[model samples]
Target: MNENSHTMSERPHLRVVHGNPTDEEVAALVAVITTLNTRDTPAPPPPRSAWSDRRTLHRPPLPHGPNAWHTSTFPH
Candidate 1:
């Protein structure tokens, strides 16, 4: 394997396709672009907690007949 091949493959993540720009200018441009991209994209919704699960709220009503207290301790 060529020793310089690894260095060659480590190209800049962002490259200007057109127009010459100074190092600081390129950095500023990248920062602005990244900020705008992040701003435009909405963040993913937060994960739902078990306490807020809708399915858990739709449980069968607890029985009121004999052994109601015992049954309530376990799933129907």
Candidate 2:
């Protein structure tokens, strides 16, 4: 027997332990369960918005010295 084999093979064997289920019903149940188990992780949260970000709200100390007020408004 192959070392990787479990039960009779590598695959898990499904059994109807409670009820006599038809093959198609068992297949549908498997499909639903597989889908639930393997669902894609939720898309990562959307990237943070720049305007609303806390870093954008940060302010540098007010400018100082001669003509500071005027130079402050103009790009350095």
Predicted model with the maximum TM-score = 1
Q: Candidate 2 lDDT, tens digit per residue, 1-76? A: 7765676455666756797989899999999988987776566788977878887677766789999988789753
Residue 7 alpha-carbon offset, candidate 2, angstroms: 4.1
Q: Which pairs clash in the backbone of model 2? A: none
Local error of candidate 2 at residue 53 (angstroms): 1.5
Locate the minimum summed-lDDT window of 10 residues in model 1.
Answer: 1-10
Root-mean-square deviation per candidate: 5.5, 6.4
Q: What is the lDDT of candidate 1?
A: 0.84
Candidate 1: count the clashes. Answer: 0
